[model samples]
Target: MRVTIFILLVFIPLTSFSALRFKEVFYFSERSNFSDSHYRNQRPPYYFPGNFAKEQRVEPKRWGEGEAELMEEALSELLSLPQLQKMFLFLARKGPVALKRFAEYPGRVPGGLGRMNQGDKKIGSVKMWAAEQPSFYVGVTDDFFKYMGHLDREKQVKVAKYIGLHELSHLYDYRMRFSFRDQQFLRATGWKWAWFLRRWENQYVPEEKRRALMKKVEEGEMSLRDLDRIVREQYGLPSFYSVTNPKETFAEVLAAYVLVPEAKDFLRPEIMDFLDGILNN
Candidate 1:
């Protein structure tokens, strides 16, 4: 989560009045691959691995060998979900993202379960970050998977699928540049859809407060404390982590909406309607 805050702090526009540009190509790198000495010798900006000489921008990459097959199999199963299928189709106008699975996500960046970059030439079915130092996207942690070998087959599949749904929801969040849904999420704060154009911070919090929260989390080692406060205050959000921010709220709820039978009651009609509009469009 802190890493996300740092990235935002660096990337935040100088003026709210200035125009913003959206990058269409989203990039993913396996943390292990990026750390490999041979790969690093030829790494592109932001650890993208393809040869940039052919194109000014390093061409995006996809999972290779056994990893590719694993992701394809998992995604094939995941798309069996109706809402997930529609959502990916809407996001991946050009194509599906090149899925690069890391045995463990890298420590350099703060996304708890995943990290994603956005650019828009559609890579195919589109698919698609947190704090203390800032992690987001709840998923199967390294510890969970390491010990997963012991679980019964049925329980193992259940946990893995739940994690996948959470990760997918985050991808959906990245693709939504502007939505009446987000505007509604922001409520009558007098903010508009355009405000979300390049801003990745929570849409609901003021800039100063958001930064302080991020810092407090990192410095105090109190990531869970903030969550406890939110639940204690009773924001009525569907998931405890969803209380982190609007982006997380949508992602967490979307995951629960798809996977948790009880999560259905927590969602509003407009949120689903907005999602439906994206799926159909």
Candidate 2:
């Protein structure tokens, strides 16, 4: 079956605003061959192949009964925002993004995963896998439903949209090669890249404070997670995972600024302003 996708562009002119507003319309058929198919034989601890161009073309997996509908709703809501729409279009310009599902893949996480294979776009007349096409593989495991069991349909959709936006934010950051301005902005929150160590380091706290925490952890006075949490909390990061690296911090903050209603209070004003400049400009 062919993959089906439809987009409706609505232009609304505002008296006060010079730019027009647009709403994204997405429709995905149940028979769409968009889901990933490389994991049929793979078992637990699935490893996503970094490059998608070399994978064999197998029958793509179909979504569970209601999964497609949920994803369609989620995508429509997510692209309604101008920032997200811009991001999607920017990536599409490099190469069309393929949406795939991870169907009950053992040990699969219950969220969206976005990856980009960066390479050349074309060799003569043929488009190459070297093109920077971003792919999104969404997984909705039983744990996802159990966690959202209490929320109504509308709320559940919101949660799904939030997760989708989070993953898209990652792709956007990747496509931009993690902008230097963004890196500088987040540096204030205590995330830094160590050239010598060749990894991200948490410098949010003072050296003295971190040393003290290390001593406590060594003495069994505090757990390592606790030490990390303390530094993350000092900057009011959205979650502990956000502090994993500057890229994650960018994704987490951007997602919150766009979807979370109370994000203005939770995130620092400077961070929100930075996102506004990037998305709007």
Candidate 3:
């Protein structure tokens, strides 16, 4: 009896570990192949006069003779503005590399490529320093200007400026919450779990339903198991992955706070109420 019990324990752990290894290998292979194809069509990485560059090589005047000059001027002015300056400084103190990158190339507008890898061309995505060094990278998808072709040149510039500030705010939040070690762990674990959880949450209950569920959990009327059941049956998320981790949840909360001030009603009321409850408690 004793020997059977020991064998079962050892066999189970070994089997689980091997499965995890296989999954990791599969994920890495798929991601690496995707990335190779994605970069194949990219530009050779040249430094333009202004910090921003479009993925395609246009005559640099497709917009007009003075468009590039205007963009640079606008970016310089925005950088010096008090609000932008404070936000940049906050990120810089946390990670110097991201600060330098932003200072050097504050905006990137990819051209002609209807969509970037992760998102459509209408909006751009930014990547901040991961607790490491001196530079940050922000990618602006072509979508930022898709419908704005009819808008005046000045309006386009203003839209870019606002979007840039929003991305910069994300950088600040990242630098504050994650340390070098924490970042390393996250990278090793991969973002698939987080992506999966987010999708699952959006599937069944809709974001609108999460607040009530969270409320129940907080009130002790619903146990963690109950929350897990709702997430699984209603949302179609794997129970283990959905409830076992809190990193993504914390980051989302922090990011929302940074982007939308508490005094404002920029976000949905339910989301704001849920976050507020977490914060106050």
Clashes of each: 25, 2, 7
User: How well does candidate 3 match the true structure in TM-score terms?
Assistant: 0.31
- Candidate 3 lDDT over residue span 154-194, tens digit each: 11234444444444444554564431224432332222233
Best by TM-score: 2
Best by lDDT: 2
Residue 163 displacement (Å), model 2: 1.4
Error of 1 at 216 (Å): 13
lDDT of 1 by residue, 1-281 (tens): 45544444456656632211111212334433333344455645433323223322222344445544443444555666655656655545633443443333323333321221111111111122211111112222233333322322311234445555556666666656332355654552223334555554433444465456555544655443444345324433443345455666666556656766654454555555555665455
- Report the Cα lDDT for candidate 3: 0.35
Candidate 3: clashing pairs of residues: 97-133, 97-134, 97-135, 98-136, 121-143, 122-143, 122-144
lDDT of 3 at 140: 29
lDDT (CA) per prediction: 0.42, 0.50, 0.35
Evaluated at residue 227, the lDDT of candidate 1 is 42
Where does model 3 exceed 4 Å of error? 1-68, 92-135, 139-157, 178-281
